[model samples]
Target: MTEYGYFLSCEEFTPAELVDQARRAQQAGFTRLAISDHFHPWNDAQGNSAFVWSVIGALSQAVDLPVTTLVTCPTMRLHPAVTAQAAATSSVLLEGRFALGVGTGEALNEHVHGDRWPSFEERGEMLEEAIGVMRELFTGQQTSHRGRHYTVDNARLYTAPEAPVPILVSGFGPKAAELAGRVGDGFVTMTPDADMVAAFRDGGGAGKKVVGGVKVCWSSNREKAVDVVHQLWPSELLPGELAQVLPTPAHFEQAGKLVTRDMVADAVTCGDEVEGHVDTVRAYARAGFDEVYVGQIGPDQEVFFDAYRELVLPALRR
Candidate 1:
């Protein structure tokens, strides 16, 4: 069975807001929760970036639903050992209801220390090495690793998880999916692309979980919803490598200008149509996703939760 969950966008919501959303999501019948781990928001309009670990702690206390990092970068901005400790602590806090979702990461979040961002190929290599380091530490055993990308000396997670924390690797393309399959316990991606899922399974993810997420807006006024998405999430429509390589929010803002309202209307599911929202979310299940998370864009979260609780979710389940 495919589980329906909610996505908590750390870039767009404050810590309190995120915690509140998690509670509300649970009340509204969401089975699980996923949250983004970003050091910076994609643009100023989004206007928030809270440390995801802290929010995770709050979420553990606020809701019973399991939480996963929609994706976090362990190769840079933070060491894998540190990330492992955090993940282990989070799992302990959630009583083993946590999964660590990782990725090579975007320069927007990873370039903060002034290190030149490595190419995707190099980043992939680093991520694989980092995952090895993390898995070793997750066992509560002392680990020392001297890898090309990172060095950890006799580091151990004393507050280790009671059970192994599943590490889900994120990817947007086939090569990344293959890498996720080769090394990850599961695979993560945003789109519900069947071909991408097939590539992942063929790359050794045959029995592993496939998780994904989507964003939609439920507004009484469709045009207003489109405007909100256009203003707050135009970066979603940016072309290929632009999202991965952009160095700062300013660069993203500059590039986001190319995305128009019409494009957002055409590409994003906006407005109060229940079927539209249900169809968008169900696509992930159709693509073989074991778990699908849906995020409601903009400030109209109450209506989204209400509608999903009363209409959309029931329709999808039907």
Candidate 2:
């Protein structure tokens, strides 16, 4: 069964708003939750980046739904050991319903430490080593690791999870997908691409979960929704490795200027048309995703929840 989830955008919402969304998501029948981890918003218009670990603590109190970091970079900004501690604590708080979604990382969030952003290959190497270290720490036993990128000396997680925190690796291409298959408990990708899912499975992820997320706008006025998305989230339309390489929100804004409203209208599912919303989400399920998270892209969250609760979700569930 494919579980439907709500994605809490740390970059676009305040911590309080995210908690409320999680609560509403649970009430509306979303069985899981995914939250972004970012040091900065993609652009000022998106406008918010609360420390994700703090919000996760609040979420453990606000909702019973399982929470996954839609993705966090454990290799940079914070060491793998520290991220393991945070994930373990979250698991304890969420009563073992937490999963850690990790990735090679975007330079936008990971470059703030004054370290030169590494090549993607090096980042991949760093991530693989980081995962090994974090998994060792998750055992709640004393751990010491010395790898090419990180070193942990006789460290242990005192508050580790009773069960392993499933690590879902995020990737956009085949190489990263293959790495996820080898090292991750699951695979995370934003798009509904069966070929990519196949690549992961072929590489060793056959029985593991495949997770994905999408953003949509639900409104009576379709054009208005497009405008809202264009103004706030044009950053999503950037092609290629731009999302991974951009160093800051300013650079993102500069690039986002190329994303027009028409492009957003064509690319994103918008309006209150129930079928559009249902098809958008169902695409993930058809693509072999075991879980799919949907995020609403504006201020009118109440209506989005109401629509999904009474209409869209029911259709998708059927």
Clashes per model (N, Cα, C within 3 A): 0, 0
Lowest lDDT sum, 10 consecutive residues, model 2, at 143-152
lDDT of 2 by residue, 81-151 (tens): 99999999999999999999999999999999998999889999999999999989999999988878898
Q: Which stretches of candidate 1 lie over 4 Å from their true place?
A: none
Query: Distance from true position, residue 37, model 1, in Å?
Result: 0.6
Return the TM-score for each candidate structure.
0.99, 0.99
Question: Model-by-model lDDT, in order?
Answer: 0.94, 0.95
In model 1, state the lDDT of residue 247.
96
Residue 208 error, candidate 1, Å = 0.3
Identify the runs in model 2 with alpha carbons over 4 angstroms from their true place: none
Q: Write the per-residue lDDT of candidate 1 for residues 1-318, one digit (tens) a residue.
A: 899999999999999999999999999999999999999999999999999999999999999999999899999899899999999999999999999999999999999999998999999999999999999999999999998989999887889998889999999999999999999999999999999999999999999999999989899999999999998999999989999999999999999999988999999999998888888998999899999999999999999899999999889889
Q: Against the true structure, candidate 1 has what lDDT? A: 0.94
- Candidate 2 positional error at 269, Å: 0.5
